[model samples]
Target chain A: MRHILSVTVENEPGVLSRVAGLFSGRGFNIESLNVGPTLDTGVSVMTITTEGDEQIIEQIVKQLRKLITVIKVVDLTDLKSVLREMVLLKVNANDANRAEILRTVDIFRCKVVDVSIDELTIEATGNYEKISAIVGLLTRFGIKEISRSGMVAMKRSIQN
Target chain B: MELTGAQILLECLKREGVEVLFGFPGGAVIDIYNELPNTSLKHVLVRHEQAAIHAADGFARASGKVGCCLVTSGPGATNTVTGIATAYMDSIPVVILTGQVPTPLIGNDAFQEVDIVGITRPCTKHNYLVKDVRELAHVIRQAFYLARSGRPGPVLVDLPKDVMQVKTKFVWPDDVKMRSYNPNCKPHSGQIKKVAQLIRDAERPIIYAGGGVITSKAHESLTWLAKNLHIPVTATLMGLGCFPGDDKLWLGMLGMHGTYAANMAINNADLVLAVGARFDDRVTGKVSTFAPMAKLVHIDIDPTSIQKNVSVHVPLVSDCRLALEALKEELAPSLAEYDFEAGHMPWVTKVGVWGKEHPLNYQASETTIKPQSVVEKIHEITKGEAVICTEVGQHQMWTAQFYRFNEPNCFLSSGGLGTMGYGFPAAIGAQFARPDKMVIDIAGDGSIQMNIQEMATSVCNNLGVKIVILNNGYLGMVRQWQELFYKKNYCSTCMDAQPDFVKLAEAYGAAGFRITDPGDLDRVLRQALDTPGTVIVDVRVEREENVYPMVPAGASLTDMLLV
Candidate 1:
């Protein structure tokens, strides 16, 4: 199963490498990762998505906590959580299927950020499943380009 | 002040307070070497890139700090794979910096280009291929952090030549934030109590200590638990020195070359309390048969390590130190009135008789001393206080059989990987980690040459590490195998006669000695012990002696074939 870990760590030198190091060192695979400053100074929030068993995830968290620079770790996947991702995809939608693509975008509450006679670029944000479904629907429309901002997540409640 | 990526690499190293580096330079790494002249860090040029990394590993093991090694691209980086793997297996903390081909040539396979990040992935704790100069400082800093933080192991950074050449403004990050790399040292109290209860109920209990005891500084706890409970103790190769060799409860090493009594104890014990040690195949010897009679109680800092290799009955995944502390609490109350006299005497006597008969016996020629005798003499001189490091092969086995290590982390060697050229650098690391203690490298002839270039590291650093080479004329262990299994076909087991180790040491400005006479063993060892600087003792030992009590590979520990 995939595990999403949201970690708050001391904003210091070598933290990201340490995280990546832990994964690669132990031979764990990281599917995606995103990091940014959190609400507090000298603290950054990192959301890491990886696939492993309960033991491996526990080991990863335990090892991460051993670093003096790491402050806390939260397995967002294990908690009730809110997640978001921003993706800007440029697709070939100009003269061929512009009307069909616009209609599809409207149905999914997505926006047409850029447009040309032959192309209509789409911007959409939702949960991972929703995003994948949107991308899956667009695949039949002769998609030209795609990109994703892995995942950024937080718990649903203040208690976590 | 703003700095270039190269400067930032040096600056971050400075911030980490790294004083010295061991490595060789080449075209790709020339830029970093060029930047070195302006920094306060000292770099030692070694003969081989592998030796350089091993030297850094030695420093790390000795000092409890991350050791640093630098190498250029392709072959230079490839040469370090063995040393990196050695560190990974032994859990030594080291940061390896390898130069890479220019970014444009990375995929083109230009001259001296290698996919180092890919090659070293499994061997390293983590690795990076830096394409952007802006991330150089963060990468280097993170390498150090990851290398030294928890269950410490080697980390690699492959810097593309282009990134090194590119000029960029550098700002040292105030902090590094990563969600996936937290390390915890604390043990759970409840789990510890359950383990203590198991230990209390265990009638035939044994403590299996590994290198973690030394790494966690839990020697006192191990000693206390063994003595208070009257439990016999056995060690994995990494666990040597966790308890005094002179202690009656000490059953020496437990595994392929382990004693029969130790193996029996592990096999028959009701509870096997394994602390700080991983159940490596070399130690388990046919995992299914290992400790067949025992219910395993495993305690380790890394939770994933528990039950990964061998099944555990009671698993308390925590640091050895914390687990020991918590165990002390639970054991203090439930402990029954124990009488060591009746239960331990017969076993002690049997081992004593075995020791006297075996006596680590070997033949010493009039012109050549025996390596076993040299080890015995060293043990005699130091009273086993010295921290001994060894390379792999027959000599490592001989050391395990003869040397009586009484403290934890006092004996360092390559057990799982069994890598050669591990001795000198690991000893250097061990010495650096514990400067007040005497550190010696007991290496075989074949093993020494594998990383002999580190003479420069010792010479430059002025570390008083004693290097004792058991100079048998052939690759002793492999030669033994040939004689036993291949009808003495010999093959390429013979060395290039012998290297002039005395002249070699002198060339590096270190003192050297060659002991060909067994009579002079005691006298020469005394002088080496008194010498202030590093001394290389090239003892000419018998060329054909084999380490006995061998269980071969893939055999049960109970089955042994002696020469």
Candidate 2:
């Protein structure tokens, strides 16, 4: 089972290493991790995606909460949450393939951020499935370069 | 008052009520050392950086206060790594202050510069690197707070040379408010009620305790619960003194080298109430089959320790003392309704039978002294009241087996890390903590030499720490392993050209003695104990003696190799 954990930690030096060390040292595999400053000063929020069984995931969450810098950990997978990832893809698009590429991009609601004489750079932001679908379509036109920001997530507001 | 960073560091320590500091000075901490004479804090200069940490750890364990040490950067900082890791493993609270290169030279590969914070991240509870003088007081305050709070462990504060030189107003915070690091010290009442109900219905209940019990001062509660319910108690190496060793309900130390009765009781238990014990691998050999018939109720302060190794049915994340107190409260109302004698008598009888069947025994020789007998004599001479510390290997096991510890903070050893050279310096620190008590370090020949230089520290401080070296001339534990599992292929385990430990002690301005015959062992030990200052007594023992009732790795606790 895949699990998304939202962790809030003190924005202190070497905290990232401590978090990463806990996962790697314990032999827990991390699929993706995104970290940035939270709204509160001196606090950072990290979203980590990992797959494990019930026991393993329980251990992971408990271990994360054990770190002195980490404030709170929420298993967002069980709750209603929104997750998003952004990817930038530069595809080779000569005259012969430019129209087809633009059509495919339009169908997927992606934007062509930059255009050169021989290539078109497109930006897409969505869930993992949506980003992967756009990347798969762009591969047909020969992707010259690609960069992906790991998934960032949050719990949805309670619905009364 | 305006003060340099070094002066501010001393001021914070004094305000924190630190009376003694164990440390070794070098280049990075020259400024601090220069300012040390002005403060009232007594500093015991150690020979090696590692011993400084270990001594401080011993002081903390014995006194229930955060141990403090200071060392210079680079190799000096790195030397304390093993000691810090040892303290971290046993959750001993210690604050390590290390001097680093100037702030500008931190990452430039300057002379004697190392990233102490980066190196100790995995081992420490928390660590900091102070780049500015203004933050020094705050960081020091936070370091002490984190080191002694909740699940206590070592915290390192790396001070750059320039930071120590900068002048600023020394302002110590009255309190540290770490929002994220609050440890849950109170057990939920509902969970306690559930566990109490389980205990009421349990046919064969066993209380498994660990180091947390000692750290949290829960021995009275643990003993009350066990006696009230008539449950047998088994303890880990770190928990040896947490329960009275002479109690009839005591199943001597449990785990790999645990007593036969303790192992069998754990094996046949129907309900295991694990308190403050993280099911360490040594404790739960073959975890799948461990307590196969038992429903485990684990109570620990560290949440991660609950399911990190072995899963339990009921997990209570709280301080050991608090949890035990709550459990006792929950059990009080239901106590009158339950028939304790009828429920647990049979189980207790069975455990008692196992205890008598294979008691820890060793034959004493007329020519050579047996190490077990030496430890037994020490226990007898001290009336089981001495503060006993040990280095790793067979001597440690013998001391743990033979020494009957009836009080908390009486037996100190490197339990989790099993680091050698831990005992001598630890004995010094323990003596400082309890000046009226007799302190002895039971060491093996191979282990005593690791930090033997600390004999000077003891003599200089006029500390009466006795070191009894069980001279087996081999790394006895490994040799036992090779003899049992590897067909007696003793590979490089011999210490043929070892130094004369007695003379070595005399050279350090301490008394020294050597006892070769069994008859002279007691007399020499008594003499050494009566000596005014530090004394080392080397007793040549039977070379082939091995720790018995051993369980091979991956074997169930029930399976034992008794000799």
The best candidate by DockQ is 2
Model 2 C-alpha lDDT per residue in residues B85-130, reported as the tens digit of each score? 9999999999999999999888999899899899998899989999
> Global lDDT for candidate 2?
0.92
Give the TM-score of chain A, superposed on the true chain A, for all candidates in the order listed.
0.91, 0.96
How far residue B484's Cα lies from its native spot in candidate 1, in Å, is 3.4
Please state the CAPRI-style docking class of candidate 1. Answer: incorrect
Which ranges in model 1 have alpha carbons more than 4 Å from their true place? A1-160, B165-171, B335-368, B428-438, B460-463, B500-512, B528-534
Model 2: per-residue Cα lDDT at residue B252: 91
RMSD for all candidates, in order, please: 7.1, 1.6
TM-score of model 1 (CA atoms) = 0.75
A128, model 1: CA deviation in Å? 22
State the C-alpha lDDT per candidate.
0.81, 0.92
User: Where is model 2 more than 4 Å wrong at Cα?
Assistant: A158-160, B333-335
Each candidate's iRMS in angstroms? 6.2, 1.0
Q: Model 2: how far is B322 from its true place, Å?
A: 1.2
Worst 10 residues of 2 chain A by lDDT: A151-160
* Positional deviation of residue B61's Cα in model 2 after best superposition, in angstroms: 0.8
